[model samples]
Target: MRESLRLLRDELSRINSPDELSSWKERFEELLREAVEKKLGVKCRSPVYLFKTLYHAGFINREELDALLQFDELNDPSFFERLLERLETRL
Candidate 1:
């Protein structure tokens, strides 16, 4: 789990465009689900809750949290909504 989070952090730091988000979001959600369902043994609603749960569990640190926060929210809200809308259409 630690290794998974580390890989996520590294990949997150490299992402600088929307071209990367769809794939990255899938990996992030999968890892969060693994951490919550297996490691932490709980259900998670949103990514924020999953990450904060991991942070409190010591699976993630402050810097990692900041990286995740920036990745998740440092953008116009509609941009992400549109991205997710488009992504959902493929399902």
Candidate 2:
């Protein structure tokens, strides 16, 4: 999960404000679900819990975490990875 955490760290750094960070939570949630499923080889029953795990693991802060879970968005893994890469450097 080192790669995943690294990716999350990169993504978090890209967040310019709490607002944008919140928006990303939804997308990040989806990404987290997919990753969890792939890594565990099973479907996750609780997306909320999964999101919380990711949040606590360093994907985002409390304010943005709430927003991201509340927001709705599509998942673009490539874009997400790129965002993470950009944010990592910025951070």
Candidate 3:
């Protein structure tokens, strides 16, 4: 794990293009969402609340949010709540 992290850091340090950065940014977003889902059970009740939590955690920003949530459409609290609830049921 440490070696993988070191390689990822090296790759990030050499990133040279907006496109490359954007791709990495998307992967980062997915990982972050996964982590949040795992840790918090995805019970967010509002987009604002989710956004605030992610922002506070420094896991996202304006551009990433715009891309990931497609300008906040995916921020639907009901959707996240349902997703978490479903995962909980499965567990």
Identify the candidate with maximal TM-score.
1
Write one digit per residue (lDDT tens) for candidate 1, span 4-32.
Answer: 65566566667777757657777767766
Give the per-residue Cα lDDT of candidate 1 at 86: 32
Best by lDDT: 1
Q: Rank by TM-score, highest first.
A: 1, 3, 2
RMSD of each: 10.7, 8.6, 12.1
Pairs of residues clashing in candidate 3: none
Please list the residue runs of candidate 3 whose C-alpha ends up more than 4 Å from where it truly belongs after superposition: 1-10, 43-50, 55-91
**Model 1 residue 52 CA deviation in Å:** 0.4
- The backbone clash count of each candidate, in order, is 0, 1, 0
Candidate 1: misplaced stretches above 4 Å?
1-17, 73-91
For candidate 2, report its TM-score: 0.41
lDDT scores of the candidates, listed in order: 0.60, 0.56, 0.47
TM-score of each: 0.53, 0.41, 0.43
- The alpha-carbon deviation from the true structure for residue 55 of candidate 1, after best TM-score superposition, in angstroms, is 0.5
> Can you tell me which runs of candidate 2 are displaced by over 4 Å?
1-5, 49-91
Residue 38 C-alpha lDDT in model 3: 62
